[model samples]
Target: MIGAATFFDGYTVIAIAYAMPVLAKEWSLTPGQIGLILSAGYLGQLFGALFFGWLAERIGRMKVLTFTILLFVAMDVACLFASGAVAMMAFRFIQGIGTGGEVPVASAYVNELIGSKKRGRFFLLYEVMFLLGLVGAGIIGYFLVPVYGWKVMFAVGLVPAALLIPLRFFLFESPRWLASKGRVEEADRIVSRLEQSVIKSGKTLAPVVEMPMAARPNAAQGWRELFKGMYFKRSLVIWAMWFGSYMVANGLITWLPTLYRQHFHLPLETSLAYGFMTSAAGVVAAVICALLIDKVGRRRWYIGALFCAAIPLGLLAATGATTPLQILMMAGLGYAMLQTVTFSLYLYSAELFPTRLRALGTGIGSAWLRLGSAMGPLVVGVAISGAGVHYVFGTFAIVLLITGCITALFAIETKGRVLEELSP
Candidate 1:
């Protein structure tokens, strides 16, 4: 249940990000114009992740999660009525608020509930759902978009809501959170269930500190917690990595099919299917990484995997497309390689900052994710319009290599550490 819900929350939005090429066609939008619309959703997501962090502190994780998902269901359904480009963009932004808040809130909530030694693998499993959602999106979009039209792509967003609604009913709140607040009875009940959920693992549930933080803190708590000492420096570097890497990802994923279609002159069905295949690679890779992340450790995998991703990206830029198979092998494989750290970033970034500011920390850092995603297509649009499509893709490759290095140098290792011990 945790895995599926957490994943759907991310995959639902990501599917839309991947489907931008088709959406642009229906609306007759230019690449930069499409980027602008996507940014609106991200802008909302930035705030949602930040604010909801605190909201969970005040209200309980389970209740807030329930409400937040309802927001996703309502707004995503409303998108069907979006009459034109302006309406579509506006609704999309509103929808972002719900979609964006769901994952960060869930991430914090889920992590707080699980024990430390297994935390890395747990988050990785959560990420596997994210990949599954992409597979769901790919399968749906590959078949539905061709037969029905782009609107059906958004309709598929409802599937998570249906699946999540029933499963979440059986969920319990984080005992770490309850214990911190001195809710001894409630906390004990939750912890016992969590303890039982584990059979082979002998690890006991323990909070990092005995300190209480269940209720709301001052506004200064968020602002001050993030900037104090080493935190400020860590924030800057992590944000840079998140921003730069995602810029490359969004630019490529959003435009890959269209680039293949227009630049390579492939058929629409063929291009969309190719895009689905490329996205499927990301799903497979993300799942594999999720399974292996704990064993390999976070630091080693992120550094090696993303660096490997950089090479193919660089090649795709330098090569001229001699054949469809060649383009798919390069562009598709490049995207697959990048997913190695895609799920890790959510886990890593949230872990980078302290709990009081976890949501805020993730919000501020992830803003760059949106910023990167927003800029990716706009830059591609410019390069395509001016220099050429080759230049756009080539530039994307360079940026990704740079992002991989930056993440390796700066982001801390969180594999063995208990979630409670994590300051960020």
Candidate 2:
């Protein structure tokens, strides 16, 4: 259910971008106008992450998750009624809040549910659904927009709103959250129920062990705590990772089809197909990363992946994207590496903060994600118009290099360690 909710969130973020080429032709929009429309949802996401992240810390994850899903769905419906770019932008920005708010809290919820030993693999398997959502949007747009039109794209979002009723009944609040709120008895009941279900399925439970920092901290953890004392550096580094990764990932993925059609003058079907292929490449990379990440170690895996992604973009920048296949091959590889880092960062972000501030920290860090995501398209637009397409990849290459340095120098290894021990 959590994965499903997040999948919707992922779909909401990218669906409009997929629809952009068609919308631009119908609405007679300039590249600047299209870029604004693309950035609006991400801008809204920045507010949603900061707001919902804070709300989750207070009211709890499940409630915030429920609210965000409903809010975005309502906005999706609103988009269908939009008659122009301004109206569509309005609907998308509000919708962005719902999508943005859900993921960080959801990340915290999933992270809290798993033990650290399997944390990377388990959480990433779930996180992969978000990428699948992106791919799903591309697939849907490829078929639907050219045939049925753009309204059908927003209509796809309505499916999750129907999910809200079942989500409330089927999902429980986080146990770590329950414990942090000092409802230890309630937390124990939930954990005990999970254990019973595991045993009922013919698996023996592992022996429980307590860590030195197992005791819960104060429940009333405010936003200030994210930047205070022990959290300061972690907060800064994770924010940089989120910002740098999304700026490239979302910028490239969201704008690829539109750029392919508008600039390269490919047929609509062919452009959308290429976009779908790019998403497929990322999905394949995500599976590989999920399988090997626990063994590779988070710090080393990130350092290597970031640099690997940069190399292709750097080569593309120098050589130029002369052929459509060449651009797809190079951008697809970089996006694959970026997707690995993008999904893994949630696990990394959640692990860095304690139970009290986990959602908020993740949210704030994700706000940078929104910031970068928003800026990416705008930057791509300006770069394409002013400096040409090659410069856009060149800018991404540099951003990846700086991000790689940050991860190499500052990131800590969290593999095979308990969450409480790592964060607390």
Candidate 3:
């Protein structure tokens, strides 16, 4: 159910990117205006991550998740009614608040459920639903946008509201969260139900092993603790990772379709098709990362992926990013490498803190994600208008290179270590 919710979050978030080309033509929007429209949702997400993440730690993950799902779904419908740039931006920004809050909280919830042994693969496989949602939007845009028009993109997002029924009825709150709040009996009851379900499936259960006690901070102290002790450094590194990686990845993905249509003069269908191809490439790369990240280890994988992404983006800049095919091939490869890091950060951020702080820390870290996401398109718009397109790739390459170096020097491996042990 979390995965299903995340899928729509991805779809709704990027659907605007796919719709931008047509909307630009119909509304006669300039590059600057287009950038604002594209960025509005991410800006809304920044506030949502901070506020909802704090709320989740206070109330519970499940309740916040349900509210966020409903908020974004309603905004998705509002998107269909938007007639011009200001209205579209307004609707998207409000929608972004919900999408932004859902992922980090969901990441914490899922991470708390599994043991560290298979956590990377298991969580990442679930994380891929978000990428698949991006691909789904691309597929829909490629086939539908030229014929049915831009409103069809928003219309498709309404499908996920139906997911709320299953989410409410079938899901249980995170047991780790329950225990951390001193609701021991409630946590055990939920865990007992899960164990009984496993036994009924005819699989032998592994013996339960006791974990070290993690520090459980009071609600007032959770936010303050993020800036103290070993957590302060971890918070800085993770925040940088979120900002740099997302700034480049989202900057490229959101602007590429519009760039194809306006800058290169490609036909609408071809532009949307090419955008779909780039998004599809990211999904393929993400799947491979999901399968292999545990063995490679989180620290090493991030170091390698960041540097590898920087290479193609640097090449694109050096080559001047003149031809659409060149941009597609080089930028697509860069986006793919970054996509691996982009989707996995939630898993990384959650692992960096204890249960009491997981949602708060992840939410705070992802606020940088929203910031970076908002900046990317705006940067692209400015670059295109003043310094030219190649400079945008040049800026991204430098950012990725610095982020790669930071990862090599500061990041800790969390692959096989238990979460409590890792954080404590």
Worst 10 residues of 3 by lDDT: 211-220
Q: Indicate which candidate wins on TM-score.
A: 3
Give the Å shift of residue 362 in candidate 1.
Answer: 2.6
Q: What's the lDDT for residue 363 in model 3?
A: 95
* Every candidate's lDDT: 0.71, 0.91, 0.94
Question: Per-residue CA lDDT of candidate 2, range 315-414, in tens?
Answer: 8899987778899999999999889999889999999999888999999999999999999999999988888899999999999999999999899999
Q: Report model 1's TM-score to 2 decimal places.
A: 0.88
Better-scoring candidate (lDDT), 2 or 3: 3
TM-score of each: 0.88, 0.98, 0.98
Which prediction has more favorable TM-score, 2 or 3? 3
Sort by TM-score, best first. Answer: 3, 2, 1
- Candidate 3 local lDDT, 345-379, one digit each (tens): 99999999988889999999999999999999999
Residue 271, candidate 2: Cα error in Å is 0.7
Candidate 2 lDDT for residue 336: 91
Whole-model lDDT for model 2 versus the true structure? 0.91
Q: How far is candidate 3 from the true structure (C-alpha RMSD, Å)?
A: 1.0
Give the least accurate 10-residue stretch of model 1, judged by summed lDDT: 208-217
